[model samples]
Target: MNLQTIGNAILIVLVIGWIGYRQTTWRPVAIGRMYRLALILAIVGAGLLVQQSHGLTGLDVAVLLVEIVISLGVGAWMGAIARFRPLDPPVRVGSSDQVARFASRTGWWGLALWLVVLAVRVGIDVLATSLGAHAATSTGIILLLIAANRVARTAVFAVRLERHAAVTA
Candidate 1:
């Protein structure tokens, strides 16, 4: 593999490690932070998509769509299974002192779901490679898929947190 491939592999491992740590630990839910992360990932992924778009084929697009669906589905599933508890003294969010925060963790289930996603992603990549769809293997496309997944999870968390706040308020 070339340096770029090695770099991508390292980046994926680091991201997975970071995500795993976050999902298993009780952390304050900052909706703004989550959205910002999703946005950043999306922008970077979009840049990669543009750089690689010239070589895409119909099959690549189809495989990409499939991956996106799977990513979003798994992310939503992870979010739905996450456990949330209210913070003792509502934490301040941003510059507004009026915000209440909660702590959330997916625990072991989140890790398991992450493994499932990785397995499925690898499986799909192998299948797509056999079918000659290069996009399936592009790190940029992978990032985009991840971005989409994050957005789904963030949306679920936002909604659930809202409901939780209303009930606790």
Candidate 2:
């Protein structure tokens, strides 16, 4: 394979490995860790995407918007289905009352949902290759989608937690 292909493969591997690590566990993620993960994604995503941005057209922009909308919906769904639990006496990472309140839920449905969404992203790569649509930039688009999904998922979870917290308090 060419060097670009190899680079894309490496990037996808990192994405998969990161997501897989998150999926394989059912523990309350530290607030610090979540922020760090988001920052990492953002940095990696932007660094890689900048090189690919030159080829994008109006049509590509529209398609990317639609994809982002769909990804946000998927993320909201994932957050909704997560099983959230409040820690008694709260495990504080700081002085704040927000003691890393996160879902530690696990099961088949989450796995299925993640896999289906992932498959759709992979499908984008396949379509881009088949149609000869800026093949070099396709991986960047896919990686950005992954980053978007992660940030969106976290936002949705936090929002839901806020609403629940408001009710409980």
Query: Which window of ten consecutive residues has the lowest lDDT sum in model 2?
Result: 128-137
Please provide TM-scores, in order, for all candidate models, with all chains considered together. Answer: 0.90, 0.74
Cα-based lDDT at residue 52, candidate 1: 67
Write down the lDDT of every candidate, Cα atoms only. Answer: 0.84, 0.63
lDDT of 2 at 54: 67
lDDT of 1 by residue, 3-65 (tens): 766876787788888889988999888877777878898899878877866778999989989
Cα error of candidate 2 at position 139, Å: 4.0
Which candidate comes out best when scored by lDDT? Answer: 1
Alpha carbon deviation, residue 115, candidate 1 (Å): 1.1
Candidate 2 lDDT tens digits, 1-169: 7787787768767766656566656656454555556667667766766765666655566656666676667766766677776755546655445466554553455556667767775676566556555532456666667666767767767777778879988
